[model samples]
Target: MRHILHNVYSYLTRCVFIFIGDITLNENRMLIGYARVSTDEQTLDVQLDYLLKAGCSLVFREKVSGAERDRPELNKLLKKVRRGDVVIVHRLDRLARSTKHLLEITEYLQHKKAGFRSLSEPWADTTSPAGRMILTVFAGIAEFERAQIRERTAAGREHARARGVHMGRPAKLMPSEAVLACRMVTDDGMPVAEVAARFGIHKATLYRILTRRQAMKSTDKSLNKIEKISQTYKCQLYE
Candidate 1:
């Protein structure tokens, strides 16, 4: 009976400690700031002031272009972020190069159970329902833009094909090289594999070239024979 009571008390104490720890962790959750400038000449004073006033405990600063995908300080901040922490940026552009990029970053933060905020754009805050709605709208717009670009590219490719433009990668073997490769295998009595290796092409590719050329020669001979027969019949009638 005493052991059962002791076990119950220990379990209750552990639950209390765990609940208290969660509260402490929540209290310690931090607001982190990120500041960036395109050039060395630009100053981060204003951004720093805003972040400090916004209660950010730490601020990551970088003098790199936001257009660059690999920002060292930004990557470090992202790595250091923890669940329940919020990452604040001076502006949306400081954090992302485009709407698609912004969505990607937010998606990553969402997966980490972190939050995001842009000081200049209230609608970009992920901590609020309204802000999340606005971001969803932005995501939809970015997706539609990507779809339109893909459609235009596909249409352009189709139009090019209709105009007899060869699509995809150019042929690896040139006309003269193909002829030489075929001859090296047939007339020179060389192994097909050896000829293909000398021509820097697969043996299968060499075989395809040979088959196509032979078919063309057969078609040409058949056409020539038909022309000769027609001429002979015309000469007999005239005689």
Candidate 2:
């Protein structure tokens, strides 16, 4: 009876230890932070400070344009985030410039079962129910605004086109310059490389112009030969 009691006590102690270990594992908070600066004039330090003060375990930052998609630090931060982790940002706009991009990032986090928190905006935390609703509304408004802007731009372009205004990059070489380069290569027997260097144009451009000229000449010659053959055929038939 004494040995049996001792064995039972040992088993109970082991069970308690396992239970404590599980609780400790569940209590670990995984928090990550991300910050961005649009230009050299902007500083990421202020954003990073707020994230640290808010209890972020790790932080990532980048000095890149908000319009750019391929941000190295942002990618690293996303990869490091695990399920049940929290991603903190100073503001939503700092994370992404466009509403579509913002929604995409947020949705990805949600899919990963991670939460999002904005230090400045209390209504921007995904960990709460109200915050999720607020973010959905905000995302809808942003997408609407972007669509309106795009429509206005398209209308403006159409109006300008109606007024006979040209759009897009201006021609790099004038028609006269292109014609002159073609003549130099075809009639003057100037080497394409020399012509390109002399005219301050790229060798590729020179080659393109020369090739176009050659194609035109070939087409003209083909038409002339066809006309001659037709005339001879007509004469022979009449004779």
Candidate 3:
């Protein structure tokens, strides 16, 4: 009985001195840090130092590109973080490639009831309400920027249309080249492929040009036949 009582007393005594609200030193939950770099030439020392000074007891480090999706250390850190524990990084860019990725990581941590913090971006601390609010502000700014970009792009396109500016890739052949290609195909009896090569145009474009010339010739012949019939009727009426 006395041994059990001594153990209880010692546990309570230590509890009284413990900072219950501080998970970084709570002895159960902890603050974990992650550091990364793109290439072997880059060093993790700077990020590691920041995380250590910020109260992280354990840190995971790796050398990998931000564009790379398979970061073993990062995956392990994400899996290892428990509820009430914090994941600290030197900066947001140190952890994620873009804002979308940053939000994804934070949302995952939030769902797990874990916290995230950036030593460089104090506003990115998810352990408190202020930091979360700051995150909201960032999201709003990103939305506003996208809206502005869309609006400006639409306006610019309208302005370009008003000025009669052509959009998309410019025509491969100019008017003179088109006329020459048609003459080569129709008059000179050159093969469409040979004309296309000589004019630096695609065979498909040459086919279109050839089709247009045939349509124009058919229309011209129809008009001439109509004119000849009208003249013959006038001569019979005079007789």
Candidate 4:
């Protein structure tokens, strides 16, 4: 019982010391800033200045294409941010090119208990309810735009097919090459792997060429038989 009591006393003393240390430590709220430029011609200085003025303790800048997902500076900024921190950007577009990507990033920050703010888009501050609503609307629009593009592309393909116009890339291998490849494999007793390697083609491509050649040969044979029968009938009628 005395040993147990001693352990409890020590635990309480450690807790008291930890509490005192925490009280002595100065807590400063982190204000992290992220800036991006879509092209080399653009500059991040303006965004950096605005972010600094907006109360950012640290600023991260990236001169890269917006379409690129992996950015070194952006990763570093994300790693540095902690719970109860604020990540500020010059604008919503500066943070992400697409609405979906923007929402994803912001959602991660929300999960981390970090706040998001945009200097240009005042309504993009996640601290307010209105900002969340605006973001939802933007996400819906972005998804709608993507769906419309897909629909138009599909409709265009259907129209082309109805007009008997072939869609997609033209055949890469010529008829002669296909025929030669088939002959080499079937008649010459050459291995498909060797033939493909010799021609600097993939095994799948070689197989497709061989199949096309066989189909063409069968079609040509049928036409030749019909021609011969017609010739014989014409000769019989002349005699």
Candidate 5:
């Protein structure tokens, strides 16, 4: 019921725009075209011919899949668009990989005060107020879904942490193995490289583990000496 209300509101808003005559469809606006093919085996002749006949002043062409995010020609056309310019494509699929992607592109064009149009899918055209209203509602819904996903992911991570689950990669060496490696290097006076190779670990890693163990031992000894001094001072005070 709420979805129906949103659609009705969007339709009403589009009507208001049309009634106000705030946006004109074909008044000194440049039509920029973009043509794309998934592979070299697929010829772009049909798309190019259609774009040229659509009165596009300039057309950017490339042979790249819509799924690929780094399309050079599409990037160029997007950068070329200015305020009041309409970007024309041979088909909807030629412009974006999915509905989310289409909404994102149209949102960007709208931000630039430009417009988007599809030769095959007339309803997808953003040059008209109705098309803009429809796409805006879709973009809003997509954003809401994405926010829900992010919230769920963060809650899941927090739950895992509360249950004492490790989040990242497991440690390479066990506690006993690390203790033995450090002893071999320090007590037995063995070469660090030889000890590391025998344990099938990197020399640098072995050094880090040994250094940490040594620092821990040093701290323990210091704490023991401090306790002894405190005990002796108490004896003197009691005497």
Candidate 6:
């Protein structure tokens, strides 16, 4: 029921903006446009016409997937937009692939004191009061989702550590293979590089494994000393 109401409200807001667009589209703001097609083979003529007909003074078109981040044309359009300018897109998906990306682009436009509108998605018009508030709400939701994901990832890493499961890429050499390589380097006096090469691992890996082992040994000694002190204190208390 709540979702249905939201959709109805959005539709009403969209109609209101469409009505507003007819009246004050070209009052003082320039309508700059951006269009995109997923592949180079796809034609952008239809989208271009829509943008131009919608009163866009300038348009930027690109032949790249919406998921791609290295869109030179989009970057140029963003850099060119100024205060009181409005960016127009044929559709919302043409501008962004996900909600997070959409919010980020809209936030950047807001920072530039510009606005955004979509020919097919009137509810996305940033020039309206409700539209600006909607963008702010979307941005806040995206941020909260990101924070939740980060917390979950941290918790998962901690759970994995508690289970003795390594969290990174598997080691290049097995424990038996590493032990043999270490023996060759230490006892037989073979070069570390040669031992690493024999085990199909890098020299740095050999040094890292040895250094980590030494650190663990040091930690064990410190823990043992602390345990002994704890035991002595308990005995004294009992006495």
**What ranking emerges by lDDT with the best candidate at the front?**
5, 6, 1, 3, 2, 4
Candidate 5 residue spans exceeding 4 A from truth: 1-27, 165-239
* Each prediction's TM-score versus the true structure: 0.55, 0.47, 0.48, 0.46, 0.58, 0.55
Candidates in order have lDDT scores of 0.64, 0.62, 0.63, 0.61, 0.65, 0.65
| Runs off by more than 4 Å, candidate 2 | 1-26, 138-239
Q: Candidate 4: where is the Cα deviation over 4 Å?
A: 1-27, 136-239
Residue-wise lDDT of candidate 1 within 124-217, one digit each (tens)?
A: 8877777766665665555455445556766898999999998773245655356445544443345666555444455656666666766688
Q: Supply the TM-score for candidate 2.
A: 0.47
Q: Give the TM-score of candidate 4.
A: 0.46
lDDT of 5 by residue, 1-239 (tens): 45545655664464344322333445788999999888755688899899999999989987876556567777667657776888999998888777756765665565456778899988777767677666656655665564555467668889999999887732456553564455444434556665564455556666566556555776654234323333443333323
What ordering of candidates by TM-score runs from best to worst? 5, 6, 1, 3, 2, 4
Per residue, candidate 3 scores C-alpha lDDT tens digits across 26-120 of 45768899998889555778787888898899999978877676677876786577768889999888888778457546655654566788888
Using TM-score as the measure, the top candidate is: 5
Q: How far off is residue 214 in model 6, in Å?
A: 40
Residue 163 CA displacement from its true place in model 2, Å? 24
The digit string of per-residue lDDT tens for model 6 on 1-239 reads 35434544554454344323322335688899998998745699999999999999999988887556567787678667776889999999998867856765665565456788889987787888777666656654554555455567768989999999888843575443444444444434556665554344556676666555455675644234323333443333323
Off by over 4 Å in 6: 1-28, 162-239
Give Cα distance to truth, residue 82, candidate 6, Å.
Answer: 1.4
